[model samples]
Target: NRADGFASDSVTVLDPAAGTLTFLSEAAKLAVEEFVSRYGEGGKENFIKEHILKNFYAFELMMAPYTVGHLKMSFLLEELGYRLQDDDRFKLYLTNTLEMEELAQTELPGMASLSEESHLAGKVKKEQPVLVILGNPPYSGVSANRGKWIDDLLKKGYTRSDGYKDDGYYQIDRKPLGERNPKWLQDDYVKFVRFAQWKIDQAGEGVLGFITNHGYLDNPTFRGMRQSLLNSFNEIYILDLHGNSLKKEKCPDGSKDENVFDIQQGVAIALFIKKKGEKKDCKVYHSEIWGLREEKKYDWLLKNDIKTTDWRKLSPKSEFYLLVHRDESFLRSYEKYLKITEAFPLNSVGIVTSRDSFVIDSDKEALKRRIRMFRDEKMPDELVKQTFNLKDKSNWKLKVVREKVRKDEHWEDSITKILYRPFDIQWVFYHDNLIERPRKEVMRHMMEENLGLVSVRQVAEGIFNHAFVTDNIIESRVTLSNKGIAFLFPLYLYSDTDKKETGNPNKKRSLGSTMMLFEPKAEYTIKKPNLSPQLVERLTCQYKKTPSPEEIFYYIYAVLYSNIYRTKYAEFLKIDFPKIPFTKDYKLFSKVAEYGKRLVDLHLLKSVELDSPVAKFQGDGDERVEKLRYDGGEKCVYVNRSRYFEGITKEVWEYQIGGYQVCSKWLKDRKGRRLFLDDIKHYCKIVTSLQKTMEIQKVIDNIYPEAEKETIEFENK
Candidate 1:
């Protein structure tokens, strides 16, 4: 039998002070005994050294970061009849691969005189032709690989030889990707892939393989990178292992699917092959494996190879050369509709308060107190930070805030009402200097009475049903379950003015103004309909009647909430902002618009229908949510040991907005806080709103088919 080499006990023997040397000695003895028994005692060492140590190239090309790893690797090699010696080749390198550099000067001119790290760097970079590079690079969205060499290489791949440094221009197809924030492309895994690709390209003909985060397979931001890969390689193979926990992915058979690695991000095995001589057009092949972790890793992957595995040939197109399979027919049909941004023509991302704890509060008084303390010149910056529990971040720092606070004149006036979450109103200090990203240009409309549609450009979780109405300033994460920012598309655009006007508070400033002035004498901020005039004219011509902007907004809301629309074009919605399909039939448009208006009223908690809620708060207790759980049989949700909310059905209890389960998330946020009478009533109203939303969605779905049958198509400008 082969010696075990104490492999099973390696973890226990890792501690150097815990007799690790003794364990290694025992393991070595076992290997020697096994070798002596296999051969003769006298010549066993010579035979093992000559045949195994010298011949096994793997033993002469090993690298380990730490002493324990080096010891374990050496122990394993010794068990296989190889032993380390003074004259042996430099294999065990104790160096950071990302930080490795060639030696400036050596004792002698040869590599032998240099350190192991320097020698390995020289060998990999110049001496050896790396035909194959394969490894699982770490996945970090906020990559720490800021080294000059790697960053320069990454920039080189994305840029042309002409040295063009335009804002959005990339080298892939010599066109701009038009991404606002493509920071995800700078992930560590992506950087490593770029590094490996650079190394392989330098060799002329080589293969690069990596099992990394699968986001690049279909993410729109990675389009440039995908095209770059196609331009470099002759053949590319992608084996998508679908197990993204954040998306809650399941096997096709309705069974639980798990990731091979203990990670939330889905992973894919990508192999890029570049052959010698004239390069041909890159051939892309894709496959997906989804099942139990063990079944996928052991049964499927172990049994499959490049030639054995079945792969579907793909012709990656321009704009986005996505590696995953897509329904081309659906994409073509879906592209006919008008995008939300194109319809509204004006939108901005919601406010991003980096110091949410310091700047925002559930209680108005608490926010006022913080602002007062912040404005006080007596209090130290560090003391204020500690009192508010504020940490210094890249965007917001105490010293910078202090400097801005000194010059501020209207600190008290900055406190404003904001929609922190769905149906969750909170107070925030909305000053440009106080808040990290106040988004003043868009928020000014909300500062007064206004309505805005909240949505996300991309949906990474649950569904693309994130559309909501907000009459107040919203947080960046108002619609998103993840770290993504939500955009606010207001119905009316407001412009700043220095012109002061004296008029009655109830009277409107102008004929076009949608809102009346709250104060008797104030600066008149001009407001106009944010709708596109050309699109409105097209809609008016199609219906033979001019539609009001409010009618258009409601019509859009209804279409976005339609179950059929969301399901039919679900794939398209995941990548970009939603598109609204205009119906030629005026009756269908009117009906959907009415339903949408009701939904908006209900969401804003202004509808009289919310007075009589279906769900009721029952039981007598502190009303503090301890461990929220649902009793499916009883149709009740337990907030604490004794208190519970009755009449909440399974569907209502599990209804998701954006990616959050509304009923559960509301309770979860107030886990330790006691629910007041108003809070209890508000929860009931939220439940009713969701229940009505579902009912309205079903109606929209029924009417959506009729609308789609005779739709008005817009020409792309």
Candidate 2:
């Protein structure tokens, strides 16, 4: 009843209502009962005369809810033997709390009629800052039609004329400082949190309580929001509900996979309070609850143990302060010793095609079929008959992309093409030169779609696959976060920016989870480094006097892939780039790098190299292994780990039906069947690679060591 220390003296209880009075009624009922319990209702007989008229208040944007809430509050008072009259100073009114203008109508998204509202039917002017500010806020992401009042609070500290500003308002986590300007703060719930703080800030002392998207607790993007909370509130309480399917983040406890809310994302209850004249550093308490339903969590909150700790123990000034930890000493050691930004100074989010169906695909043949379908239904010859040319390469984006075919000329001129994905109905672009194969063979075997996208292809054992192809390639991969391609892909690639000539690579891209290597910079629409030769050599070169790029790359890579790094830094791996730990000892670092090189060689070893030791091994699969793939013909690789080629972990076949999970597209027929020669080869590579990677952790442990995690072993009493 007294959450945030509500008392008889707290004459104002306000909810910037989301069209509900249910909470207000509960609060009133609690306030009346508590008053009776504590003071035995010394003189007051009616609840409204004693409590409701002066203390209860709410503001809503919609008229329907406002009216219903007003009536509900009146009836609730009546039920308690106190009837609310017309002049009883009914505090519930139609208003947009975010945009608390002098007027309430003509504001609120699509609620133009709520303009005629003031303090309790213009009864009480709330000049004093409220003692308690509380409610659940909407968690929708920022939109084109989002509230301007909220947007200003997100982009800047103050909204319109409400000039409450905090120094921590604009903080974005950085690699080279401001490298990652995260927009996740634009989420709706963040704005509400800020708004609550603003209300408290204006009052100079008050409590702000909210049940919200738990991302604010640990998402690196919301660090600024957390910072504001620290600056404003001296005492904070965080109750985490760990079930986020949007992130597919499971509860730390063994609860059901589903979250408390209907939505897929996780939720949390946070209470922030700062009393008048309190300016000392904030003290924070953290706890967690988990279950399939909201009621299960509620039951635990009231009846069970609350595992909590001092917030300072999490190291608030650290890069990811929201992580739960007993101590951050080892992490501090890694921070002082190693840094990833020294090598890779830039990164970016992968391309977002707004239209996925026409642009993205697992099967290139299927993509071509889409093109053919469009051609048959809507092609006009006049639009295709005209030959087009442009002087500026920039203008080429507006025209079309052409797939490289055997002949330069087109038999497709009459095939009706206003716009198609750079290919004729019958033609297929060979990702590699087609001098070796039939057009039909290229179409059937080589996976190529949309002119430059090549999904897969297999060839001779001696020949390199995908090592030499060029032409504005975009290896759109998000496997890093999913745990699949994260370890397998190179932190830096030794790509031939210029074909047929190879040495130290002139170009490189860091492909990994949580890292945004240089963003789309050039005409190719791919992220590139500042084009500094030193950066390229550092990540791509295999040999140098000392601290070679290959050595640093592998050293960092090996450290990143280890379970030590994963377990110790689990919180950071979410929504953040790697903050790599580096070493000054060339001898120790080089040895680790050597191991990294072996893994790299194994990972990049083309499936075409059939007889090579790396490509000849085989393994087995069973019911536990739900998905596996291997090319039935010549020299193809097998993936026994993930249901999808891009995903990291293995799971049941049912995982694919989820919108973004594409495991269903992998070769499912071979899942539980006998392992192929190619399949075993990849598994062997993973096992061998992991064995080598573990060495780096040991090497690092020898120097800037990790704290031995306490283990609990149960014995029979």
Cα RMSD, each candidate: 8.3, 12.2
The sequence of per-residue lDDT tens digits that candidate 2 reaches over residues 63-134 is: 688778878877887776677665574577765565534554454564334344543333322354566667
In model 1, residue pairs whose N, Cα or C atoms come closer than 3 Å (at least 3 residues apart or on different chains), thus clashing, are none
lDDT of 1 by residue, 1-717 (tens): 113322211111111111123333443345456556655577655644553333211111122233454566467656755676767531333333444365554554533444645665445554344445656667899977678776656555433222323122143467666566778877878877776666566666667777889998887788878887887778999999989887678886878888988989889999998776536899999999998888665589888898988899988887678898876667765678888988877788888887798888888898887787877889988888789887787766777877787676656666778888888888887777667777877877676556799998877755677889998889998886453678999887666541235222112234344443322123435666777766788887888877777888999999999988888888777777888888889988999899999999999999988889998999986888899989999999999989998989999999988777889988998889999898889999999999988998898888889988877776542
- Number of backbone clashes in candidate 1: 0
lDDT of each: 0.72, 0.46
For model 2, the local distance difference test gives 0.46
Model 1 score (lDDT): 0.72
Model 1: per-residue Cα lDDT at residue 269: 96
True-vs-predicted CA distance for residue 475, candidate 1, Å: 1.4
TM-score of each: 0.80, 0.65
